[model samples]
Target: MTTAEAETGDTLTEALTEVLSGARARGGLFHRAVLAPPWAVRVQDGAPLSLACMLRGDGWVLHPAAPQPVRIAPGDVVVLCGPTPYVLADDPATEPGLLIQPGDCCTTPDGTDMCEKLALGVRTWGRDADDPTVLLSGNYQLYGDLSTRLLDTLPPVLVLREGEWDAAVLPLVATEVVKDAPGQQLVLDRLLDLLLVSVLRAWFARPQAQPPAWYRAQSDPVVGVALRLLHEHPGHGWTVASLAAEAGVSRAGLARRFTGLVGEPPMTYLARRRIDLAARLLREPDATLASVARRVGYADGFALSTAFKRLRGMSPAAYRAEHGAR
Candidate 1:
């Protein structure tokens, strides 16, 4: 993927806006709030949020719910889930292994009032953090939320140190990220969005050795078409014949290509997508198993339960009980 690939969804500006909107809509609120010196940043009241691409220069460190203080330098992007209070700090070597929470305030050992807040990128809550979180020397992307499947294959953090890719556009954006102005908050949000996109492009550019079967298939015209359709309509009653037609291939061809590229047949993808959607719906407080089953093409709650258990290794109710928000 090139910078052009990041700009692929629509016109350049529209694609950029769409990326921000996608991140915010999924995450819920886009916090354009600014915190300078004397005020520690607090996200105690929002959904699970992620901060990407925006670097925290000196004077700040991230104190997450986890005890370890994550130090931030120029080009470091971090993601925090839950309403846990993460503070920007002047000192990061204090807490080593305690679970912290929102509203939990601490002091430096000397008690000198240790942190001065700094401008960071667009912070949003409730979005998927599977995108990307990175740090780069030049054209760098600090943080992102691609998809869980993608991130699972990466090192905990991907760092693009110094090169043409780094020098291209990330540094200019980083310089602007450190600037302060009246509407700088707005500027910061947009720049953060671009920085994340750049990171994904970089990831795709330097191809992973032996990319996942799903990603490799995502490039195939037939498989890609099928994937987009499945993602767009997970609730649909997708049949192999239907998917084959949708992808403009024979049923046999589709099955073989799909298995070869996606590492599974069409039905497997459909089932996974359905179950994934069902799992998400189950997590919704208002939805019932029967309704969720119907939505994902199962004939009844029991049937959905059987299949869900097979795929997730737990009954739907148990899964929900342990994991659901409400």
Candidate 2:
């Protein structure tokens, strides 16, 4: 086998890590559940991603299209990408007793509120306190448009079995979720991000995994260095010739190889990266539109606003307002 084929696995892993980092968790929902037998909760399709871990006892995750529900044992982590509803229950035969809607709202099937009724303690909720089953669940609410590349690559359901990955941060997240102190939410958000990266790292390492084209293209010697440079310095004014020179290849060779491997020309990819970075910066209160524009390679706020509105369907100020940023 050639050098490119040999290093494909390592390059794909690095590319996935880079892509996933673009969708950093802002403020998500975390809940600690303690339940007993004969109980089930129907999770609606709203959040972009949902993560559940079996902390104690066992349960089953039922999907509508699956022939059989998946069993979840202790230490098992499951990630569900929506909008597809699923059920978590003690057994596959159990009917859903409660419904979970967007914004973490809970209710009965008949539309009666259940959030306050099932509250156990800080960040804790379930049918019973001394229940046999315990679970740690998190929901990622806000993901930028750039995350579509990574999210589209994932399956509807992914399960990482116990001992398959290192989850040292799980315990820390479980502990911090119940804290009512200041900055506790921030702590949980960071921990959830770590958990997600760790799980994906393990999943992509499986031999049978079929990574995306861009991920696979990172193995090429020329494409790999160019990708790194583009990702590391999105604000730099990069042209085809400049990128080719930096990667030690002629302009024509680099353009052909990069387009063939990555499915897009180098300049197009760079533009997308700059827009992604600008979106993230717009969420900061101190970062003005002009400042964000300059930092992301645009000439001024007007140039950035035009592109942002064209690509994101909103101006920078409108985007910030929608996201509740100052």
Candidate 3:
């Protein structure tokens, strides 16, 4: 390795070792706060999502899961996730009920709800939304929509106690999110991206293991090129020979390098990726299984079924019924 490569690898290794050590903790590697009014929002199931953090105004609430009512006031941030219904309000009893759109409120069981006003804030996995308005005066709920594989590597929620560091960064992001300025979405997205890196840094600083093999390859020129090609062209008939040629390495060398870094040879990775593509296609109500299989490079529906079952623990039809978009 060159001096720069060696230094980069060592630095990455050390950083990963530090961050992953706290992998089992309650803290998340990504977080954000919202100051917008209560608005309506609904997320479809199987959306592959997460909430890293939420801030109201000044104080902060960490891990907003509770058996009873919890007070969320101005400047208090609460973090939560894992596909459960959570309502942030001034009165816990007044938490909005079913059919209550986002940016609104409902009632609780015993009618002892504590929050009256609502402000939505969130940290998400992707940068689809640039500036999300969180001004508390009007009724609005900040919603973020994005899908990223990186979520698989992070903890569910982490609510930090508001402090100097948070003040310096979070408010700025929240302002950008609410401003809805020109190219503000792009600006906010980039900021969130950097914030995610900061969270990862904090995680590693606390001693974490190396991230998943795919994420790690983001820094590897050789492996990154191969992975990008595979991700971007899953429909293409890719082979070890073709990929090696594209990577400018011998088949044996490419295979060795790929396996060393990705923990699997190129072909095995491709098969899994193909199956993943098939699974996604099958989830579409209009996509036929036969077409999905053919598109992913399987010869026929039966062959696709057999391979899908082996890799995904379910037949394609069953998987579609369970996960398909309704």
Candidate 4:
């Protein structure tokens, strides 16, 4: 076996796959926007994530914190880390006359619901149906604390220009999004995930890009294997010595290396991961605390509750109630 393979037993692509496995779109809101000049939309949906692709013409993304508006040319894709409001316009000066709220709620300046009133067609909306400025967008709610690990790494607004990477999926995404047919939601959901994964892969491949700490640890021969073992078998009772033996490293060596790279001790990191997994499981309507506890390596509900509350500052029950309301 190659040296790196002997240690980590996985490639960077495989690492990314393991991480993105949880990102599935369930009834995600998608729309095709065709707008003429003097157009802008204020998106304040408070979703965990959103993706926008410029299919034709040009536009700008205006964020409250940004000193300048970022330009989007045709075929460019943008990943928005949201819960923060932002505006899209033909020009920076064109103010938004409409507000897009949660649950696909759209309102005019006078607070009138215009969701169906402005429906151009199936999953299409805009001032003019034939407008040259076309944008396709998908809003996704990245439920569960597990997604927070991935989401924490992204900036509020990240644009992947066409020149930066080949947007091969753009054509398929554009075509699939507007279709009104059977199993369309499933098709769109898969397409959305594919497009997102492609965009993220391209972005991370950039020379100047910075990925999450856990992601960066994938390159380490020792820590990578340890992390993979922990992630793959989170339910396992992994002590430092056990993990070290499995990784073909001494316990002290593994401890120092893992802490330096992953920013936490082995068992501490495992505990956090377990709780994160538990938090995700608690989001499921049918999952009881005890079941989630066993799934994440805790002996029972009390043990799980202690760890979950200690780390997350909220009880599992409270976390479930809050997310259930969402």
* lDDT of each candidate versus the true structure: 0.51, 0.83, 0.50, 0.83
Error of 1 at 29 (Å): 17
Stretches > 4 Å off in candidate 1? 1-73, 77-156, 160-213
Better of 2 and 3 by TM-score: 2
Q: For residues 207-267, could you state the per-residue lDDT of candidate 3 as single tens digits?
A: 3345567658746777666876787677788888888888888888888989998888888
Q: How high is the lDDT of residue 146 in model 1?
A: 29
Pairs in clash, predicted candidate 2: none
Whole-model lDDT for model 3 versus the true structure? Answer: 0.50
Taking all chains together, the TM-score of candidate 3 against the true structure is 0.46
Error of 1 at 180 (Å): 23
TM-score of 1: 0.47
Candidate 2, 152-191: lDDT as tens digits: 6687888889888776667888888889999887787777
lDDT of 1 by residue, 209-263 (tens): 4445765555566887787677667677888899999899899999998998877
Per-residue error for 289 in candidate 1, Å, reads: 1.0
lDDT of 4 by residue, 21-88 (tens): 65667677788988898888999998888888899999999987667899999989888878889998
True-vs-predicted CA distance for residue 184, candidate 1, Å: 22
